[model samples]
Target: MPEKVNGIVADAIRRVRTSSGVPLAFAGVVTGPTTLRLQHFVGQHVGALSGLSVDVGHGLGGKVVALNRLLAVDDYLRTPQITHRYNTLIEREGLRAVMAAPVIVDRSPVAVIYGAMHTPTPIGGRMLDALASEARAVEQEIVAARARMEHAAEGENEMRDRMTAAFARLRDLAGTVDDARIAEELEAITRVLIAGEEPAEEPTVELTGREQDVLSLAALGYPNARIAETLGITVHTVKGYMKDAMRKLGASSRLEAVVTARRSGLLP
Candidate 1:
């Protein structure tokens, strides 16, 4: 599990370096409850920082993970805020400025992404924002990967594929309807097809028929562009529906929204 997470974080670190134009960037995935092992580095002059074990509340990455927030220092070696646990490694790599962004999943920190400069410079808002955005992207990927893993582990891939196809066909049929009432009824029945049995307790949240349509496709692991194409809507409109569905489901990510809807008997 840690290795899979490290792979995802490593790819994300490379992207961060490219997008943020940072001189140095590294990432680590959680190896244990209180520890994260540094696994991947990009733009580093030396390998001193590689494979370093970081503990919660110990250093920049640790603090970011502990607090579940982004943190940066102009001069990491001379900073009083974070512990100098990796001062020698930082010095070996000639790192001065550093920022750490927590990759959180389901409200828990799963990884940390670090960006650094070789000289003493403040980690600006733009760089911090870019790193944070990448972290969120990583979080989404991790969640979706986990969902795939769980689905495979449960040996339901075959059933899932059939359900996904059936749902898509039903949605296509629903689209052909001229009457609003008939279309809505079709959507309601599609929801039943998604969730095998009606939930005993009703969910407090309510999503419009269109919101459910978008979210149902999302549940099948369809990306927004594909969902838009299939539903004959603009990508921007697809995003709007997804955003509204996530808000209504109290979810922070697309996978989370899908999971919540399934649990709420809104999707299968």
Candidate 2:
């Protein structure tokens, strides 16, 4: 069971106790797949609540635990359909009309709550709806917390991988580069990659390494014919590369593409 669900359960008990004037308010949490453990019990005597793990389909709580639904009984001592184990607590607390509601999450029952009174009265449908609403709110909080944790985990993993790859590159180039200037340049690249900066370029106009090469020349005031001649491609092919580059760079004109490339460090 999620921790947030417990808060909702405790709050629900308070709500029921306030509205119904019932002294006996208890919360039962499922310890395992088949065992419903009494988590919180409030009354004159809570001693009977100890070691109370009802197995599925065995005791009064077991029936409630097994059914995964709310239950009520006006006559606990004489309910032939239910077992007699919890009768002691019921009798001790002067509880007669015992109410139980199952806490459900992801279509599975994870916990159960019980409220009892010395006498019998029909537990209202609105109270039941309140119980269900509280349960759903807790489930939503649990799911949202899980999603945030998973997203953080993914970001941590990505940063770790990028740092590992950067170190490997530096290690490979260590012997060839003896100057401090080259080493400082490599460290700066490492910091930028670790920070998750997207090259200061618009993601809508993301560019390929080769496409960048083509655009830099275009930005340098070269015509398609001249660019194709210099780069060993036809004028039509040059136009195609420029089109793709412009789309990625978010540039409506040749001047904008060059500026975008320079800012992104692709041209520089």
Candidate 3:
């Protein structure tokens, strides 16, 4: 999970740098209830900021996490809103204009992404908007990853139950077998079934949390508008998620996507 989150944060900051032309882009994920560690970096010239830990309400990134909102400063060293605990580190990195957005999931901040410039050029609204959008995408991806993990756990339990039932059925059938050889074969099969042999691997299909959420609701015969209302998203966003899910599932329609998701253990 930590590696997956690092990948997501790396991709997000990379996109932020590419789209907004930020001279430096970096990110840190929440490692504990009060810890955020800078783990991913792009366009950085020095290692001063690498692996730096920011606690809640301590530094720029910390303030962002504490506030759960976007923050921008034309000169990070002189920003009154955030404490200057990382001044030496920021100075070594030569960062001036800095902005950060909280990657919030389920109303809690999970990570912080930042964009900065070498010169003290005021960060523009467009850049802030771009950062915010990427942060939202990160939030969605984290949610989806967590959902997939949960579904996988459930699938394990279901498999165990099915195996137990099959073993019982096999034992019952063995008792009725007239041929001694057949009975022995049945008993051997039952032993193999209960001996924890590796099951055949199934095809893997990945679905984002929002995509699964949209498909699961759609499976309940809800329209896009209703799904949006229920999930607190726009109808257009719901459709987009559904479309992406369908593409991943190789389904042409919502029903097919739902069916494929269930078969793939993406949906309950």
Best by lDDT: 1
Q: Find the candidate with the highest TM-score and give its number.
A: 3
Model 2, stretches more than 4 Å misplaced? Answer: 1-8, 19-21, 42-45, 166-176, 179-268
- Overall local distance difference test of candidate 1: 0.86
| Superposed Cα deviation of residue 64, candidate 1 (Å) | 0.9
Rank list by lDDT: 1, 3, 2
For candidate 3, the per-residue lDDT at 17 reads 94
Q: Positional deviation of 50 in candidate 1, in angstroms? A: 1.1
Q: RMSD of candidate 3 to the true fold? A: 16.7
lDDT of 2 by residue, 1-268 (tens): 2565566566666765665556777776777888887766555444666557777776566887778776777677777878887677667767677777776777777777676766766666765566555556555665676688789999975765455444435433533578988877865664454345455754444566447546656655678897787666788888888888888777898878877765675553
Model 1 per-residue lDDT tens digits across residues 1-268:
6667888998999999988889888998887789988878888567887788998998899888889999999999999999988888889889999999999998999999999999998778889889999999999999999998997877785776567667766877888989999999887878778678676447879988778788878877788899998889999999999999999888999989887887787765
Clashing pairs in 2: 205-248
Each model's TM-score, in the order given? Answer: 0.57, 0.56, 0.70
Local accuracy by lDDT, each model: 0.86, 0.66, 0.83
Q: After superposition, how far is residue 197 of candidate 2 from its true place, in Å?
A: 24
Q: What is candidate 3's lDDT per residue for 1-268, written digit by digit as tens?
A: 7788888889999999998889889999999889999988899668889999998998889998888999999999887888999999999989989999999887888889999999888889899999999999998998899899899999986775465455545655676779999999987876575345432324377776567567756776789998788777899999999989999889999988876765654554
lDDT of 1 at 87: 89
